[model samples]
Target: MKTLAIVGAGPGLGLSLAKTFGQHDFRVALIARNQEKLDTYMQQLREMHVEAAGFSADVLHTAQLEAALARVKETFGPVDVLEYSPTPSITDVASVLDVAPENAQFQFDYIVRGALAGVRAVLPDMLAKGDGGLIFTMGGASITPTPMMGNVGIAMAGLRNYVSNLHEVLKPKGIYAGTMSVMGWFKNTDETPARIAASIYEMYEQREQGEHVFEV
Candidate 1:
């Protein structure tokens, strides 16, 4: 069976994605910083009879992330699908002049550095397999920059570029990489967890060479 490794597993998109893929018979490996939440999510997956495992690691910590990914590979084989979806915080939303230098640094470290770290860690295996999917959860701010959300927007823009570049570099190798931009509010809409999960699955299922942008 195909395996999926989802980083930044949370209450919304992460958990929903897990359930969606699990229902479709994909073995799932979930990663998050909170052990408790991971355990809770695993239990929920079990209720659906999904083969699931959890790993705890802050994406900002490269060593921890590496260890976690190693464990995932050992358990589920080379990951067929990878989802990167770290939730950005208010610290990640600061303007250059409004926040302390250290705070801005932290935001940059997590928003940009953490994501690149994940891509670096996973891309080699995907390239070797010559068939894999890297899906990044992107925000509208990437397309329309907001000064109030300065740092986060800038970091997301960088991620978008990274995804596009990766697509160019890896498509020839049969590794499909792309970013899914959530252009609308996810809360209180018909665009619920199920809808988003279906969209992601559809993208993964119908991925084409050089397809790098999925705006939803």
Candidate 2:
């Protein structure tokens, strides 16, 4: 079976993606900062009969992330799909002025640095295999650039462009890279976990070389 590595596993997107891919028969490796949460998620996946393994590491720690990726590869083989869905927010709705400089730095670190680290951690293996897919979750703030979410918006913009460039660089080698911009909040949508999973499954199934953006 193909393997999928999902970074930043959480309830909203992480677990959703895991469940989605697992249902489609992919051996999934879930990475999160909290061991308790990872264990719980693993249990839930087990109940569904999805092949899964959990790793705990702060994405900010590059060495930890690298080790986790290595473990995943050892267990499930080189990752065929990597989903980066980091939650980059200190306060839910802090104005530009209200957000502390440190908080802004954290957002940038989590969004930009985290994604970069993940790409670095997995790309070498993917490139060697000459086949893989990297999907990043993007928010509406990237295009709209809300003042209240300036830090996040700016970071997303940077990440989106970076992934675009990766797509161009990796396309010739049979690797597909892209972002899936949700465009709005997923919490209130009728798009259930299964539906989201189907969308991702279709994307990977139909992935073409040089494709960069997928606005879902």
Number of the predicted model whose TM-score against the real structure is largest? 1
lDDT of 1 by residue, 13-76 (tens): 8988998999888999999999998999899999999999999999889888878988998988
The RMSD of every model to the true structure, in order and in angstroms, is 2.3, 2.6
lDDT of 2 at 181: 66
Against the reference, the lDDT scores of all candidates come to: 0.80, 0.78
10 residues in a row with least lDDT, candidate 1: 207-216
User: What TM-score should be assigned to candidate 1?
Assistant: 0.90
Question: What would the per-residue lDDT of candidate 2 be over residues 1-216, giving only the tens digit for each residue?
Answer: 889999888866777788888877888999989888899989999999999999988888878888999899899888899998867644544556667777667677778888888888888988898999998876777666578786677678888888889888888888888776655555623455445556666777777633233344
Model 2 RMSD to the real structure?
Answer: 2.6
Q: By lDDT, who's the top model here?
A: 1
Error of 2 at 153 (Å): 0.6
